[model samples]
Target: MATSTLLLHPVRLRIVQSMLGHAQTTTRELAERLGDVAPATLYRHVAALVDGGVIEVVSETRVRGASERSLRLNLSRASVDPDDEALVDDERVRAGFLAYLASLASAFDDYLAAPRSTLEADLVGFRQVAVFATDDEWREVAATIRDALLPLIERSERPEGARRRILGTVSLPVD
Candidate 1:
């Protein structure tokens, strides 16, 4: 499975977020999806993802006299090993969680960049919290979170649609 890369910086994370669940995309298309990302940076991150196996070139064709490669997420190389204790460490997990936060924020920023005032937010809200719990209860709590949100995430799926907009946050300090 693909461990998140040391090179999976902000831009690359955005690229992957755009590419999720898709069959493939050309460099130009990816750049368009990732508005404000330079073509060169897109290509660089795509190459890194290819190396990382987070994405694979499903096909390559010459488009407009330039090489255009189609890309898709490769599940074969995508996962976080739950048993890997390092992934559970406070520092490493915090970094991974931060990466997730960056991805979610980037996705929002990209959507807002779209030329559509046609969209309206029917509701907007926020929550703040500090959770303290025993280790034995942590697994159950995590399970509750997944069970609660997975269906909400599923509701946003639309055929032939761009990725849905959903934000999630999870943080628990080691006290």
Candidate 2:
């Protein structure tokens, strides 16, 4: 399966997002995180990703007579390569992008609805700013942001007492 095609399905995308930044994960954990998805459906999609080479099983163990697997994403295989002919499908890309946005919105909604939810106290932020820059300057800005974030992005272990935080970014140019 083409990388884009494999990763773009809404459910698969959610799986990938849940796995991101984690060094290893199991289907049981994924089921807990994605409570709305049926366990069978989640397992099926996970199997597909494994078969497609997008995620690999790192180890397996028997727990209570059932084999449990630990898996991680193949980051190199998680992205849509420019050379992939599948990139020509604008509708596919659009649908996937919409799915991504929808997931973020849903996450935000859940956060807001939770008891004792306070945006300021939680350090939550949602804002947009327009930037004027030439192509080279824009590239520099993006590179700077990535460089600053690489350390945190590469960390797989969470700190003690640290809660999970979501940070999402989207860039669009309008002439």
Candidate 3:
């Protein structure tokens, strides 16, 4: 499978997201966290990720007559290669973007299904702003956003008083 195809499937994407900011974890642990997904389905996607070299098994142990593997993303291969992106045609790019939108919608649905009071107390937000900027200005804005978020992304694994949050950004030229 192409790296983007392997990584962008909804289930696999969620699996990768769950692993992003943490130490190595076993498939059993992942299954527990993603309770909505069937164990077999989760295992199948995980196997595809491992086969595609996006994730690696860091360790293995015998557990109740089965081998449990602790896996983590191979950071080097976890993202689509820039060279590969250059080779992708426009249709592929649209498909990839659609997949991303679907995942975003699914996440929002899950959040809304949670307790109303809890959702209200959380810092969740969505907004859109139309910006008129030259290419250079747009690049500067992108860099500024990245700089502001990099520290928080890097510190995501902190154990104390830390909550997991999903941050999504999409920039597209207006027609």
Candidate 4:
């Protein structure tokens, strides 16, 4: 049972989060979406993800005379457990969590920067928050949230039109 926090360093976290829900991405696509991450730096992070078994090479295609590599995550095995808790305490994990969050923020910021008009309903994002009861309350709330979002993902696996690639992360805070 691998701990997600042990697996998710700042750079590795960004790469995994970005690659989630997408069909596949080449090293170049990842570098571009990640922003300001030099290819060498991004490649190192990507390699780490590959080594961790969080992300795996899915396809090879030719682009500009180069063999472009595509990678995707192994969803069934992707999770953080108590043993996966790499931090000494809540404070340390929070710091890494904040850094992990900022990368997600940057990804969305870059998305909004794309050439598109606000009239497009598909080109939008939103957030919601709720306070819970006991630790069990928090756990149930988290499970409910995952339930709500998972249908769309399962739908994407069916033979359908081109699926829209997206990334998602759920934060379940506990003390």
Candidate 5:
């Protein structure tokens, strides 16, 4: 139940993604949002996350003779530690990346299933460009992108006109 092991699982990763930057939420709520996952399966992953210290139960209430627990991601314990990252083998990295790719594909499928007019109006896009830069320059580019997005990420909880959007980026060097 190491943080990285817990996170690398596809279901658990999806659960973490759904809970990121949000307030406390119940397992029932999670199951609802992840409508494709079985309730039992979702519950099992939630328990694993809780046991792994990646998430915690913030509150509990009795409802209809059953206890409903509200859980929140423990941001401090939700990342692969730098040292642990160095220890991850190639197989593990490949597995994690595949899981992420599967999720991305699923998201794209969902987008396509939506109304075509809505999709077109939303300014959605997928594109890639090759940029040549020194290592230091690449680091600066990454930092600048993060700095520009940090405010939007922080304001995700705003209840106004904000809509959910997924932004995915991958940078790799070609041999």
Candidate 6:
């Protein structure tokens, strides 16, 4: 399967998102985190990702009589490179982008559906920013973001009262 195809799937995208910032995650843990997805379906998507090289099984151990696997995402394979001619099928890529947006919408809807959702108190936010900058300026801004966020990304300890939040970034030129 194409990387874009594998990565942009709604369920698969959620699986990837759950694995982000962690060095490794177990199949059991994924099953628990994405409880809405059936174990069979989740296992299928995980196998597909493993086959596509989007994720790798780093270790395996037996829990009871069953085999348990520890997996990690290959971040390099988690996105589409439009410049890579071999991977660019215009329609597929566009569809994948739409699926990506749909996943974000679904996440927000889930949040709203939660009984105790308090957007302001929860610090939930989504917005669009339009920037006019030369390529170098844009690179600098991106670099700044990376530098500032990298530490948090690398932290393995979950401090008290620090709830997990998802952050998504999209940049596109205005035509």
> Clashing pairs in model 3?
none
Model 4 ranges off by over 4 Å: 1-7, 61-66, 89-92, 116-132, 157-175
lDDT of 1 at 152: 54
lDDT of 6 by residue, 36-112 (tens): 89999999999999999999999999999999999998888877666655455777667667777876776777788
Error at 96, model 1, angstroms:
6.0
Residue-level lDDT of model 4, residues 32-94, one tens digit each, is 877777888888777776777777899888999987788877776455655654555777677
How do the residues 1-175 of candidate 3 rate in per-residue lDDT, one tens digit apiece?
8888787577887788777766578899899867888989999999999999988999999999999999988767777764775436777667666767777787788778876566547888889999889989999999999899878766636778776688878887997
lDDT of 5 by residue, 1-175 (tens): 5677888789988888778767678988898878999988999999999999999999999999998999988878876674775336878767877877888788788888876676558878888898889999999999999899878766636778666778877788975
Best by the TM-score measure: 2
Per-residue lDDT tens digits for candidate 2, residues 1-175, read 8888987799998888888778889878999889999989999999999999999999999999988899998888876686788878899989889889988987887787788557798889999999899989998998999899878877767788666677888877988
Alpha-carbon TM-score of each model against the true structure: 0.65, 0.89, 0.80, 0.72, 0.86, 0.81
Residues forming the 10-long window of minimal summed lDDT in candidate 3: 79-88
Candidate topping lDDT = 2
lDDT of 1 by residue, 1-175 (tens): 2354422356766676776555567777888887687877778878888888778888889877988888877655554555655555577666666777877777666666775554445232347877778777888988898798666544535567444455455656755
Residue clash pairs of candidate 2: none
lDDT of each: 0.67, 0.86, 0.81, 0.70, 0.82, 0.83
Cα lDDT, model 1, residue 144: 91
> Which scores greater on lDDT, model 4 or model 5?
5
Model 3, global lDDT:
0.81
Which residue pairs come into collision in candidate 4? Answer: 3-84
